[model samples]
Target: MKTLLRLSFAAIFAALVGCATPQVPVPLDQSFYTADKKTVGLMLEAPKAPGLALEGNIGLLDYAIIAAATSSLTDHIEGQDLGEFLAVAEELSQNLENEGFELVRLQVPEKAPKLAKFKDPDGKDTTYFAAKDHRTLADQYQVDYLLKLTATRAGLARPYYGFIPTDAPRAVFNVHGEMIDMSSNQLLWYSDIAHSAYATGEWDEGPSFPGLTNTYYVVMNKAKQDVLGALAKRESATGTLALNDDEEAEATESSETPAESQQ
Candidate 1:
């Protein structure tokens, strides 16, 4: 029986490893830092309305049931004030200003469309946007680089294995930012910030899930830190610009620290 259990768990782990999403990190161009004067167009998307996302292979009936059970919790989460999270833009803008870049806010008439993703030459799906297409925005803004921050979602993520819950629901924040060179429409830097904090106590406190609510804010702050950390400049001992891959890894590790239960 133990051997059977071990094999079953191993198969599940293998399946998860096989199904993991592909990510290609592009480091920030060193030329931006070297340039005497830099102008950047900043486009930040409005944060997505909050709610619970049921992930994993859930059946139709199970999804409905989960939704029904979490309706109140969802509403409570949706009504949360995102002022703190929204302020991240200001913080990011200040960071750019400190780096000696003149920041230009690019206003969009409507929310930007979901970033178009496609498989790369290696057939792996990538988050990088289509090249040369954003030149129009750059031309209009008259900036050397475009810094786009996409706040995809802020809420809870409930992963499941069919009808069974794999773990406790987690308050989550998902955002991704990128820097593009307008001259060549090449991706210079990419940061995918995703942070989740599990509730300290029971997750299903109806009406007002205080513990989960608090955790939500904690995760949001972590996400914000990740965005800033990714943008922070780091140089190697040899005075050469370092790749952000290590910083991204460190951010992931820090964001994983478990949250203490809050009342």
Candidate 2:
């Protein structure tokens, strides 16, 4: 009975993941990032307790059982004094400062729906939360833009195919982040990125689960680095605007110099 259920679930899960279309990210618009809209409300999701995610195929009953069974283990992992999650968040805050953004740190209900997926007019798959959905947050914070880093999931990921392990378990960290224009409800930027790392040695360490724990931190750091990298690309784009301005000024001066020489 269990074997049959597992197979059924695995086949469905595999098909779902396999058939899903990839989504293209919405790029940050240069005009929206201008000095006129320097104030941005920064919202970061609160971290949740770590646990295992079963992928491939698994029945709902079995999934629930496993989740309940691993609750204690997840709790222990969460209590290990591994470290605080502040470093990357602080790094993000500092980067926004360096970019001349007036950061207004704000809090929203952690569980509030902040994103939605849909096809744009061009029929390209894209993810964005409705602009009006965040209007209250924007109005409350009195900011014209909102930048959000949604909650993260940190734990082990095991992929299975019909009662067979497809690959070794890995530590994973994932989150969805976006920047939106509150006034127009335009999604200025959005990206869904994840990082995972495998254990270097024995992973089934009993009470402490050190190997998996270490890998968890590895992916966590990588995930944060991913955010920084994406933000840097956007900042670099803003720098291009500055470069264009300089070139224009030089062009104007050169044109005037030639006119004076002709005079």
Give all candidates' CA lDDT scores: 0.69, 0.61
Model 1 residue 251 CA deviation in Å = 12
How would you encode candidate 2's per-residue C-alpha lDDT over 213-261 as one tens digit per residue? 8777766655665566566524453553232355458546655742210
Evaluated against the true structure, the overall lDDT of model 1 is 0.69
List where candidate 1 sits over 4 angstroms from the true fold: 1-23, 109-132, 161-166, 235-263
> Which 10-residue window of candidate 2 scores lowest in summed lDDT?
254-263
Report the Cα lDDT for residue 164, model 1: 82
What does the lDDT read for residue 31 in candidate 2? 60
What shift in Å separates residue 14 of candidate 1 from its native position after superposition? 21
Count of residue pairs whose backbone atoms collide, per candidate: 0, 1
Worst 10 residues of 1 by lDDT: 1-10
lDDT string for model 1 (1-263, tens) is 23223334554676788775544676665656767767988887754466676667765566556666667876788788666667877876776787788888888557654434432344344325444366656556899988887776677777778668788888888787888877656677876777777888797877888889988888877777767666666674465434357656875686597543321
TM-scores, all models, native as reference: 0.71, 0.66
In TM-score terms, candidate 2 sits at 0.66
Question: Which residue pairs show collisions in model 1?
Answer: none
- Per-residue error (Å), model 1, residue 102: 1.4
Model 2 lDDT on a 0 to 1 scale: 0.61
